[model samples]
Target: MARIRIAVTGTDGQVARSLVERSAMTACDVICIGRPMLDLSRPTTIESALASIAADVVVSAAAYTDVNKAETEGALADLVNGRAPGLLAAHAYARGIPLIQLSTDYVFDGSKSTPYTEDDPIAPINAYGRSKAAGERAVAAAHPHHVILRTSWIYSPFNRNFVRTMLALARKQDEVRVVADQIGNPTAAADIADGILEVARNLIEGRNEERAGIFHMAAAGTTSWAEFASAIFSASAERGGPTARVAPIASAEYQTPARRPANSRLDCARLSRVHGVSLLHWHSSLGPCVGRILEQGT
Candidate 1:
């Protein structure tokens, strides 16, 4: 088979970097465009870059990810996360290719106790979530050939994520205070990358219209942030790395500019049933990543 060309936004993001790495192991080519060449904040750049790239599929992985700062920088977040995706979808539609937009679980208000499904109504409590919700709408409106995959609690060895932060803090301190109230799947970026590839391939090769829709794809299981930290430390300890005692705290105690969902757990059944993809359990993916960070110090 001919190598599939996957055009992605952003170069340094965990998902984009992981996609490039994962594509190397497959018959797919990742063309990552970002920053000076293709900034999400700049609409003209997104258009020009997508127009020029002869890709089989496009993945919009970059976004204004600072949850707290987004409360203050709502305008920038709106432009990057809200309006940019429509342009990506419109361009990809013009070329008759599928566009995949990476979204978040923050779109929900966290009122429901169970895992969120694709049909859940969005009532974002924060600026970042609102912006991402807008992007999802724009992508859906702009093109029929779009897949909005909402993921949660992304971590990897490549970028500054929860796992790396926890490990680094363990190096400096004995006990770590983490919020235990907010629960979600601690998805590995590597797993998200692989899932993205599978979904893109289904759309690209099979032209599977069933795959072009919103889907939740997260790590198999769920845990509170504090518990996730404890699990990470446990994995680190096995590798003779930095270990820490996790002090579980409430969301009220550890406040942030953005109010996170109490329950960010996503039901990924549709992603599996439609695209034939499912991520490993949180701990299963997390252990290897923790081991890598501990060993390589990435």
Candidate 2:
């Protein structure tokens, strides 16, 4: 049997990088492309990038992910986050390849008392969320074999994510005030990439096309932003890293250009049941990430 060919966009982003690495390690032919070479700013580049890739599956990890900045840069965000995936969907659909696009949990307004389901009504509270929501709609309308995964509180060992930021701050400051009110699970980027590959395997192996849709792919439990910070600092401490006290504060205490969903918790039940993929608990996934960062001397 021939090996599967997987093409992943946004090759430089943490999520995309992890997926590419995993794909390579698993013996899959992975074509990972990034900006300038595969510029998402130019909408036509999406199709052009995938044209000669000879891929059986396409994972779109590219996006304008600067959330706070998106408030002032709405048009650019729309171009990259909204329109690009739609174009990719068109190309993937034409090639009969499954398109797996990463999304965010910001699509919800945070009013839901529990984690959000796939069918939950989308009401983005900020420009970033709006752009992502638009991207989801575009992919859904343009392609039949597509999976839009909405993940939140994403942190990885390699990226400029919350974990990294907390560790840096803990070293520099005596105390860091983190938002205690905002709640969501901290998803490991590696776990998310693995989950995506699992889904892609099913899709490429003659699995049902009906499996395509929006799915929440976060870890199993939920915690507030403050609690999450504590977890990061605790892990860092255990790893002989910084261990500054993380002070709890309300979201209002920290001001930014855009508003954040108070509760970014996503209901991943549909993802687990439909794909039959179980992700590790948030804490369980933390140590290895920390270990990797330490090994790399980050």
Candidate 3:
């Protein structure tokens, strides 16, 4: 059997890096494209990049992820996060290939007390969320075989994320302040990459064709920024890494240019029912990722 070629975007991003790393363990050939080759800001490069790569599936993992910065740079964010995936979906549709487009929990207003389901209404409060929501609609409109996997609080050892930020801050300061009101699952990028590979395999095998739509993929548990920080510190302390006292503060106290969802928890029951893929608990998944970061001093 021939290995499936999986072309992914955002070569420098955490999720993309995870996808590349995990692909080595499977029979899939993961090709990562970014920057000059496939710049989201320049949509013209998208088709050319896809045309050059002979991929069985396309994973649109790249996005302008600066939540606070998006408030002022809405145009660039919309181009990269909102419009680029749609362009990629169109190309994928032309090639009769599956396009797995990553989305965000920010699409919701986080007003619901319970975890967000795939069928929940979307009311994005920030520019970044609005852009992601736009991307979701565009991809769905462009291709029928598209999967918009909405995830939250993505972290990894390979790139800049909450885990790395917390650890870096811990090294410089004895105390760190984090927002307590906001809550979400602190997902590992490697876990998300694993889920994506499962979906890619199913797509390549022509299974679960009816499951081509939106689904939530996230860690099994939830926590606030402060709690998450404390957990990171706890894991770090266990490994003789930098540990700091986490001070919990309300969101109002720590103001940002963009508003974050108070509760970004997503319900992954649909993903389990449709794809039979379940991620590890956030706490359990954090350990290895933290350990790797500490060991690498990254």
Give the poorly placed runs of model 3, Cα more than 4 Å off.
none
TM-score of each: 0.98, 0.96, 0.98
lDDT (Cα, 0-100) at 265 in candidate 2: 88
- Per-residue accuracy of model 2 over 31-86 as CA lDDT, tens digit each: 78787778878876777788868898889888899999999999999999998889
Count: clashes, candidate 3: 0
Ten consecutive residues with minimal summed lDDT in candidate 3? Answer: 202-211
Ranking by lDDT: 3, 1, 2
What's the CA error at residue 12 for candidate 3, in Å? 0.7
> Candidates sorted by TM-score, descending order?
3, 1, 2
Candidate with the greatest lDDT versus the true structure: 3
> What is the per-residue lDDT of model 3 for residues 107-141, given as tens digits with 9 covering 90 to 100?
99999999999999999999999999999999999
Error of 3 at 221 (Å): 1.0
- lDDT score at residue 88, model 2, on the 0-100 scale: 89
Colliding pairs, model 2: none
Name the regions of candidate 2 deviating beyond 4 angstroms. 296-298
Deviation in Å, model 3, residue 39 alpha carbon: 0.7
Q: Report the poorest 10 consecutive residues by lDDT, candidate 1.
A: 203-212
